[model samples]
Target: MITRHFIDVPRTDGSARRVHYRRCGQGQPLLMIHQSPRSSAEYAAVMQAWGAHFTCIAPDTPGFGQSEPLAGTPDINDFADALIDLMDALGLERCPAYGFHSGGIILVTALKRHPQRFTGMAVGGYAIWTPAEMAIFGESYLPPFQPSAYGEHLTWLWNRMLEQSWFFPWFDVRGEARLPGAHADVARVDQAVREMLESGDAYRAGYGAVLRAPRDIPAADAVVPPVLISAYFGDPLQAHIDRLGPLPAGWQAQKVDTPADHHQASLDWLLALPPVPAAGLVETPHEGFAHVVSAGFDGLVHWRGAVGETATVPAPGGAISLITGAGIDPPGHGLSDDWPAAAPTDRTVWDAVFAEVQRLRGFAGFDFEPITAGDPHHLYPDLTPDRFGSHLTRAWSVVRAGAFFRPRHQPSAANAIAFDSTAIAPDRLAAKHLALLQARSARAYHAAYGRTDGP
Candidate 1:
């Protein structure tokens, strides 16, 4: 069952704010932070899935929900500190986390200053606002604290918020033009608007809190944890999407076209990942493409660009010249210029890879992994392919009939002991693979089976 309680979290401002928080389920703790202009209430659906795997703890940031506001000034940094205080109070020394929008900003701040306190983080719609973006937001988001008239205030907030989100130029203009290349479910939009209206001044205060916030939230590269950035269509954060490209190596960017898609994707990601260990680097466009080709392995070769039949293959340690999609090598074609086709040719090549994986792994051919639930190769993306390849190549050394390769648990005892071969099954293999992927626990196996680790 979901459990909630009220507790006072002391701010650095020498005052305490009453925070409404909910904690549920068990296992490693997970702290969830809500975006500005919204309270922790937004994460109700997410908590259900996450709670199963984590002790999901969500708190209403001060000035939103039923929490008390700061008497003077507070910014994202302050919010981070408050979260730390909450963690200490709850006796959670370290916890993995997820956040949305402004909540993501706070998480970033916390990551930079107190990196050790968190296990890892997954965030949705981070806006690394530029100076110009800040100026635009200040005007619309940071409206006056005290409005002259209640009706005028409500109308003004509604128009500003809606226009900023749905129209082009966002804070710069007012129009009915749908944002360029942006789309959303009409019913969802209606529901969000209805909720926003119902929340009243608390929403306004949180909106202003983010609007007036300091734009330069420093990147905590030192705090290397596996971070996933998820974005939806019509999200204003898309404008600053490129800024997220150069984050900590362990960080990953996932773009979902709709809110519902983003929600589901995030839930799946959180459930799959564990506390990060080594600070791995994210793959840049060139590095990513190079790895895709050089490895000769296949799953997904994802790249981000708009409107281009032409693509450039990265040269050895350098940027290669631009060439047609058919011209470059992402495993699919040659430079015989073809006319514009209805669908992308790359999709066909990807389909071929899927088919190959299916044939070998004996699973369904699907775009994303987990081709079918309970499939042995369902954990394809999460499994470090290089390690799996090494194991497969050296199968004789690691395995014998009635005994499977198990990472040595400790160095002091029998290095490799025989286990019942009948117990070795596909589901057991999948579970073992997942346990190894958890960054923190991966090293725990090195003492046993000292096979080379891979990304």
Candidate 2:
């Protein structure tokens, strides 16, 4: 089974940053890096496949996923260093690594800086962009992605991710820029959109760093670990192999016919390398999250504050506040796990779940209270995604209404509550909007909990 974890890596500034990762399978450790604007979630299926031979460890590179972003505008070198920091935190001295697209670029840069840190690398696509292509990409590629007051950004986000499969530069609509594998797959596009939303504007920092990164393949004479770089037929980076000029000894680049073939080739190459032992692997504890496996549920549950304190589950549209640190997102809400396939309908299921959480967190007793409002059917809107992305605006409307009224569905002046101007600010609403999007099971959780009366 695949599991998620968080580890705090000490930085040069005498502080620590949390890095979120996914781990599965067992054997020698294999570091997996994902492409930009996406998280380690991208490697879920592949990790399961590769788990039999190696302990697949994939981290969401800094600033892209739940991982904390580096200070200031960082360059590619910074990202490479961050990967090494993660390695050190995990006590991984050296291991075979895998990457795809932007992931491959970061791995290549890391190998160049610290050659002895990796035994071998199986890279899916290593981009070597020319000056002309870089010019076009730099000009119109990554625009500022701040959330707008009315959620206009969501419309652009949905289309941008959707059309990327249709065009090489995504924004370029010319016939020459069209991809042969152009597709309108909604599921694929929706996942990408969610990831980008998680990263928010931070996507520019991580993705821009790669776009601006120089073609840094080590020289033919430079000593380095063996690396195999391959790209599939429909991938735009397949043509970049020609631009790689000359790779160091023991390095090779080739084109493959399909994604399956590329994955198989990568697995074969990594399997041939000497295995790195798992003796040094360390289990690091994350500060604010706990792994809970209670009756009818199993996954990470994010919590804050000392055990035995006031434990409260936030309402349908609520999240654990940074100020009070009192609320916990129930299973299937916020950063907690999604509801199980056969999730229990009984409201008492939550009482047992919280009890398990208290046990896991070392709370003495069940001195807890759940905070809720409105009817379950009315409090949680059906923000299910549509092809046109109307869900984005719908979510924004609900979140915005929540600021001025109790049981946000009732927007009458009689239901209005007093609040500061900052309550309805765009940035604040954007945060709530994101929480709603992230809460995959908010509606179901509410349905199970039923409703309560409020002012």
lDDT per model vs. reference:
0.50, 0.82
All-Cα superposition RMSD per candidate: 24.8, 2.3
TM-score per prediction, in order, is: 0.52, 0.94
20-126, model 2: which lDDT tens digit per residue? 88888998999999999899998989999999988999999998878889899999999999999889889899999999999998999999898899999999988
Query: Residue 92's C-alpha lDDT in candidate 1?
Result: 70
Q: How far is candidate 2 from the true structure (C-alpha RMSD, Å)?
A: 2.3
Clashes of each: 5, 0
Give the residue spans of candidate 1 off by over 4 A: 11-15, 145-150, 157-165, 168-177, 180-223, 272-455
How does model 2 score by TM-score? 0.94
Error of 2 at 143 (Å): 0.7
